[model samples]
Target: MNRADETGLAARQGAASILTAVLKERRAFDDAFIAEAASGHLRNAEPRDRAFARAITATALRRLGTIDHILSLLIDKELPKRAGATENILRAGLAEILFLRVAAHAAVGMNVEAASRDENARHFKALVNAVLRRATREGDAILDNLDTERLDTPDWLWQSWSAAYGEETARAIVRMHYADPPLDISVKRAEERMTIAEALGATVLPSGTLRLEDAGRIEDLPGFDDGAWWVQDAAAALPAKLLGDVTGREVLDLCAAPGGKTAELAAAGAHVTALDRSRPRLDRLEQNLSRLGLEAKTVVADATAYAPGRTWDLILLDAPCSSTGTARRHPDVPHLKSPADRDKLAALQARLLAHAATLLAPGGTLVYCTCSLEPEEGVRQVEAFLAAHPAFRRQPVGVEDVAGLGEIVTGEGDLRTLPCHLAALGGLDGFYAARLTRAS
Candidate 1:
């Protein structure tokens, strides 16, 4: 179906249709679905209406588990199957009343009216109305008593972080996801940083990253077409910076694709060799570098297997992982991932770290990083690699090295940027990074 049709189906047809389309089609949250379904049709949705629809959809998805919990307590019979339109209408209405704090009268009136738009949804009207009213009246009790800490997060994720960082820290991390993340951009030329910041009315972060309140359509930004800047998070930029004084050195960006780190390396005057297993991803890297007028020796091969003719002074392994740390930017990741996925990715990271170590010249640096919050994929992976390769030692980052990053460093000196830490500035993605040196 066309985008317009899909949205119409979502809004008029009920919340279940939108959620169904997302799960079955494996698509991102269809704000359009919520809008069309919420509005009873898809034509001419203004920006404000679209925003409200998006908020409604996001609230429901984020609190899907809790909403279900509330339903189980109130429903006399099992809620209709998820694929049914009845269940979806209930979910959307519950999300608004319970979580969104949307005014009860307005929320109920709109939901009931929206449900009547489709005959299939008619059966759900009584259920939706009763549950929403009960939730609204007793909402304070539910909000006060239901574990806000566990409301939206998976059990494994909540338990893991709580065990590692304490309940307060875990709750703080969870709280950060309730809001939208700011637009963080990394400039290609240091000189353009100020100009871009001024145009967007943003502040220059201590780490030299740009933090815009909300710069829509990055490509439309003043310097974007000119290739003067690219979008990289403040935390993601640290791996390249940790290599320290890379001028006139040869570096390898292993598994570099959508190559932000590669661009940073090239900008730092390193003759970079970029390698990846996927040719299409490599092609994107080449295109990015070309846009910035930077050059790199591009190779399409598995980083674990490809053998370049010579060793290099530095190598960066932005290893794949569970991506738990990036929940704010990519909320869908937590839903798609399983604990098994985390374990599997950890095993792969161990292999990539060992393999990347071999390509670093004696006395050179190997910076390992991942957008994963799990210790198995971060600290544990590094510890395992160090045990196997005694010649390499953890050269922990110093507090003075990276502005605004010293606080997130673990006792062992690895970088760990959590969403909670960045709440003041709209937060940053979770990341783990460590620098290792090979014995000469």
Candidate 2:
């Protein structure tokens, strides 16, 4: 095969391998992609081809439910038991035909060619060709009256969202996933944010997050190396701001790795102590800080167990959870996580929140936040914390605090943003943050 054909085939195979890792091995998508690279499955591929592989993998995962539904209609019977990547190959090909704008012939011919080369699926190459070719001609008719929103979302998520936000709102959230979310960034130079946005051809989100639509390869963006801005979802950027006027305050950031929140706190003139358990993640955070020209005291210690010598004036805890709110950006979330996963993470969050409350300085502010849609991780978690610890009371956030996105601030005044909240601007991640303080 020529180099171009070989590159395209390698991309397709790499995508299928990643899909297999996620679906069959039950690995996280990012981890699987990393494994593919580290293991040399994609390390030798050209940059453009590697990107294509990632795109195909992400698209297949995101539209998995819909793709599976279509496959059930076209394939009358399953293939041989030993068919290794054949099913995923069909999935990747079909996703390209239906969602991506690849030419029908390329999708079909390339996928068929891939099947021909795989020892396990070579016998069923005809099946792959027939199914994908038929899908090209009849896929639209089958999708015409289908409830794609429901099909695309897993039952556990749909039911949980229905119970938490009600059925109508759950459907709306599902619909929001269909639109490609825009990249929202936080500019360190507040006075120059507008100028940066203008230079990058970005729209200033209501929350002051510069929204960049179709900005390819974030590292390639101008000023990225200069650390002028960082890619943070508009909703994800709200929590650090809740510790009002953090200038010169002693700030502790728990779970601060990959430190978007830590960067925010530092940029706002806080004397920051960033703590997390993972050394590698902390190294990355430190690297990010270096690039941004920000400074923070870093510690590799568990948030739940660490008891520092003294308390801080302000603390920001962006605890880890099921991460369902990031489904739009990481489509594997709905497939990889479950209610049990939420419960497990909720327990950890409780431990972290409880420990954090103890470490707050008297009359100090504590801001607890999570990028999770589940109530147990957000509303309920804070409610339970406040109930158990009467000393700390909620310091209700306001619309003005977040640049007038009132619809996101809850009735009780916590910042509760949904992926469907800012529909006109392609929506933001679902996030819940509560600002609290202990009385003097």
Candidate 3:
């Protein structure tokens, strides 16, 4: 094989490995797969190859339910037990043939080549070729009859969103996830948003987030190393803004690792103390801060256990949850999380919320947010918190607070942004945030 073909082959092989990791080994597609690219599956590949590998892997995971369904239709009978990478190889190839729009010949040829060479799957090389080729020819007809959104999304998530947001809206959310999420940048200097966006050919959203379409290789963009802006979802950026004008006020950022919110707090001139349990993630936050020329005191401790020995003027507890809201960007969410996991996270969030409440000064504001579409983690979580802690009451988010995105403002006046909320502006993450105030 020539150099280009070799890279292509590696990318396909790498995609299969990623699928195997997510599907069989049950590792997070981002944390275990892409984050470890240099030392993991794509280690030997070039940057372009790694990107291609990621695209293929993400496509497969996003459409695995339908891909598996189509594969079942194509196969006459099940293959031998312990089929090695056969399923992944088939999945990666079919994703290319169907969703990714890769040329049929290349997608089929490379994956067939992979199967023919692997000792475990060599016996099924012909089967792989037959299945993918037929998919290229007959896939459309089959897909025309398939409810892809229903097929692609997990049952528990579907039912949960349906119960929370209504069945029609839940379907809309799943349909939106079919498209890749747009990149959103949060600028340090709020007034400079338009100038910075124009320089980068990006548009300013109603929420003041800079939305960029087709932004390739984020670091390669202007103002990256200089840290003029950091990548944050438009919806994810809202909660920080809810804690407005932090100028010189003391603020506690609970569960603030990989700190976009910390950066916002620091940039807005809060005497910020960012806390999280994961030292490595906090190290990343520190590096990002160093790049942005932002400053914040860092604490490595669990939000549920940490004791600051003093109260703060404001607190932002972006508690940990299923992160289902980010499904458009992180396709592994539906495959990885479950109701049990949501329950587990909800329990943790409750504890963290309770602990954070104790650390807030009387008459202080605490903004609790989660990138979860699940109600148990959002409205319900805060509702229970307020009921138990009579000292704190719902301050209620305002239409103006979310930069005039009134469609996302809930009836109770919290922020409940769906992934499909701003579809005309390339959709945002499904985020929920409630502002609560403690009485003096």
Candidate 4:
């Protein structure tokens, strides 16, 4: 095959690999898979090719529901129950032509040729061609005009969000998921912000984060080896900052893994104990601490069951939930997760909070947080916890306490962030963090 044909083939093959990984292998959608696939076609594939593959996969994932809806419109009776491979090719191609604005002729021809190579895909070429061509002209209106309710999210999820945050905010959340996420970084030290931003070709966020327009290999960046900073969304870095005046105080970082907040705790001169369940994940936390030259006591124990011997002055509960708020970064979550998943996760979060409450010293602070947009997992979860345990009271995060975080913190003392919050600055991650105190 010639150069043009080679690139086309690489794109198709990469998409197929990613589809298999998400659907079959159940791997996280990331750059590693694309890079691995590129090893075969182009010797030392350029970042451009890697980007093309990632875009195709991300586009297909974000718009899967809409693309499937459009496909149903084209078929006379129904598209055959063909192999997953064939369906993935059609989905990838249709997504590019319909949603991503790739040329109609190019998308259709390349996909058809790519499909013909596989025995199961050969028969679907005609159907695929028809769908892509039809989508090329009217696809935008078809997608744009569809009921946002039926776009990608489950009805129950939409209803839950509407009930909690109103219909407008909920719909805005859905819309933001389809928007691309910018790469965000948190500096280890304050003064390094300008140097790091200039070095990585990033701009300094109002929140003091380094926001990169285009995220490339981190190892090649200025601060990667020196450990001047680590990659973290601006919103994700807020909870630790809100835990005010931790210097010379004992803090418990519950559910700390990959230890970003734990680093913050140590950096603030807090005597920190980082607890997590996974040994491998804890190993990573140790590695990160070593890189930052920060020391913290590490424990590998379950959050719901583990108990520290004594009470802590501060506790950071980065509770696990459905992680729906991170959909822009982890697009597979919405599809892989169900309403049942949220309910189960909420139950577990409540359990963890119940346990963490016992470990807090009188008048100490506990910051309950989750990288989840779902109210059931955040506000509702905290509300339920407060109701169950009267000793714990809301210690409101005052505007003066947290710099650059006034908008996200609610009057009720909850930190609520959505993907739409900083759209112009390449939007922050959706998350919720609440600071509470145990009465003396």
Maximum-TM-score candidate: 3
Candidate 3, 233-320: lDDT as tens digits: 9899999988888898989999998999999889888989999999999999999999999999999998998886998869999999
Candidate 3: misplaced stretches above 4 Å?
Answer: 39-41
1-440 per-residue lDDT for model 1 (tens digits)? 56543443344334455555555455555443644545544345544455566666667777767877887777888854532566666777887887777778877766766666657767677777787788788867876878865868888998889987888999998888777778887887787779878987888888899988767667787877888877888888887888998889888898889899999989888999888899899899999988888899998888777776778878899998888888777665666688999999888888899888888899999999999888899998999999999999999888776785667888998988888886788777888899999999
Error of 4 at 288 (Å): 2.2
Runs in model 4 lying further than 4 Å from the true structure: 23-27, 31-47, 148-150
| TM-score of predicted structure 4 | 0.92
Q: What overall lDDT, based on C-alpha atoms, would model 2 receive against the true structure?
A: 0.90
Backbone clashes per model, in order? 6, 0, 0, 0
* Superposed Cα RMSD, model 2: 1.5
For all candidates in order, the CA lDDT equals 0.78, 0.90, 0.90, 0.80
Q: Could you tell me which 10 consecutive residues in candidate 1 have the lowest summed lDDT?
A: 5-14
Alpha-carbon runs more than 4 Å astray in model 2: 37-41
Q: Write the per-residue lDDT of candidate 4 for residues 114-176, one digit (tens) a residue.
A: 777767777877766776777787778787788744567766767877887788887777777
Error of 4 at 201 (Å): 3.2
Better of 1 and 3 by TM-score: 3
The residue-level lDDT of candidate 4 at 164 comes to 76
RMSD of each: 4.0, 1.5, 1.4, 2.5
Q: List TM-score per model, in order.
A: 0.88, 0.96, 0.97, 0.92
